[model samples]
Target: MLKSNFARFAAVGLAAAALVSLGATAANAAPVPTEGPLYVYDGNGILIPTAGHVFDWNDNISASLSATDMAAPFHCSADATDSYTFLAPQGQELTRSAWQAYAPNGFTAEGSKDLLAFTLSPYQQTNGTQGVAKVNGGKWSLGLACTKDNGVNYASSGVWWLPVTVEAGTGKFTADPVGDPVVGSPATIDLEATTVPVAPDVDGPLSLNVPVGAKATLGAAALVNGLSTSTGKLGEFTVTDERALSKKGWTLTSSVADFVNGTNTIDKKQLGIKPIVVSGTAVAAAAQVAGSATGSAPFAELAPLAAVGTTKLNADLTFVAPKDSVVGTYTSKLTLTLASK
Candidate 1:
């Protein structure tokens, strides 16, 4: 009986050992260790996420300065402030000192072709989004110089307007991966919603000097031909809107009161002087030039909004002085005003 009991006990112990070996094998056969989000490297790269995923850096930000800011002849500065709420998931630990910088490829003057850059600091965050990262100090300050040609001041030089945009490829951002392998679209710098100020400029002065001895009914071509003799060539007044369609359209208002010499004034009707816009065989009324633009008459519209070059318009006065008028130096202010429409 004792021998039989020992055999049963040994057999039970052997079965228990076999079960333990099977459990070990099963544990070893399990799948290999998989990395978790804690140490993940997403292929999409890092994201400077804005509200609702709308990357409208241009639309969300605005740059403004007093006309006085750009009124100086040599240099001037204006303050520009913009606020946008952004969320940086992978950048939770990022501090205000850990700022990001971008090199805008086309934010340069049109003539000098000088490029510009700006920096953004993380100031506030909500949930995962920051509140306000003021681009203050001197970063938002603009250094501009007044340009003049032949006693005429130029407001814009093409380099300051037309808002150069960037999206994914036009610009880049700085980054640092502290913990896990963080990735982002650092190249995706959107400018579709942003717009910069443009200084519209008009060049060429219209000066007509015809003696009373000259014949009546002076056509545009004749006036230009005669004036060309003294003022090189009678060129059209070139209108340039570097801001283009980024803002509202502009207008060219030409109005003349009457010829005046000291206290003497030439009656408007007697002068018979009207600015006429003649293109080929199409002749339009005075005040209105180029095409029959929308809004009001006599206002030229800025079409082909994407165009960067200048548009030229030829204007001349139809002199019909009375044959019996008194002889004296008659002068009138041919007022040409350019304003945003």
Candidate 2:
């Protein structure tokens, strides 16, 4: 019995060992084949998530897609052929008129290809004082066609609003006379006009000169022996006394004639000598009368009373005295007057 029991025990131990070995082999064996069938396809039609194809967080798109051809907006251009205007007084010329171009945005500008081709119109509406006209401030506009390299050609039109101003030439007028007394005298008056481009806030004054005791002739110069000259004899004599006159807000300055000394003589034959003809009758005072003395007198009174037999006659007389009398005493007064012209 003991032997049979020991043999059964060994058999049981062998069975248990076999079971442990089987469990170990099963744990180490290869996994069973997957149930799905294998196949291949081009990645072209595959659907992709939008997030997968995004360039960045801001721009999301499918990774498998692309945008079609796109284009920019079309451009247009326009311009004014002429831009500047010039004005001038009648019988004047313009010095300069230039035009320039500018771009405010994406457009580009270049110098005109044909500068000489620009045209200018003749001056119109010419009055006695002013003239008006138009001139071509040369400029051009280019079209929106693509550049030679197939890039968008950014061309723009430009305009120039040039400032126009009037240019006047020198002008002239006749001169008018200014001051004097009434005497046969010579004087010069100046003729002038405001120069072109007159300075700011300045007005020019015209002036003239006349003899101390003479009047000026207006319009035309005085004629001497049919020849025109500034000097002319007065219609009446000027008073020996100084005088003044005013006209047109101007003063006529004048001077009186000066008298110094005198002598007297008488002889019908001696006074009537050739080139020395004695003026008819004279009084003792006649020889002494000098400044602006008018009228005639007989010589008999001018001669001193003669002795009953002696023919020689002599006379003492008082002469009109000059204000400042001396060796070279010459006294005169200046008067100021105005012009009417």
Query: What is the alpha-carbon lDDT of model 2 when measured against the actual structure?
Result: 0.20
Poorest 10 consecutive residues by lDDT, candidate 1: 5-14
Where model 2 places Cα greater than 4 Å from the true spot, the runs are 1-148, 151-248, 251-253, 259-327, 337-341
Output the TM-score of candidate 1: 0.25
Count clashing residue pairs per candidate.
16, 17
In terms of TM-score, how similar is model 2 to the real structure?
0.14
lDDT of 2 by residue, 1-341 (tens): 11110000000000111101111221111111111111111133332221112111111111111112111122223321222222222111111111111111222234321111111111211211122122231111111111111111211221111112212221111111112211322334566787532334442332333334554221333343443322212222111111112112211222223322233221111111001112322212233233323312231221222111111122222223233333332222223232222
Query: Which is the leading candidate under TM-score?
Result: 1
- Tens digits of lDDT, candidate 1, 1-341: 11110000000000111101111221111111111111111122222322122222222221111111221121211211111112222221111112222111222343432222212222222222222222221111111112222101211221121011122432212222212221331233234576643444532222222233432323332223322111111124545555533534455554555656677764544332233333322223344221122213352444333344344555444443444445555654444566654
Residue runs of model 1 more than 4 Å from their true location after superposition = 1-235, 245-247, 269-299, 303-308
Error of 2 at 269 (Å): 30
lDDT of each: 0.27, 0.20
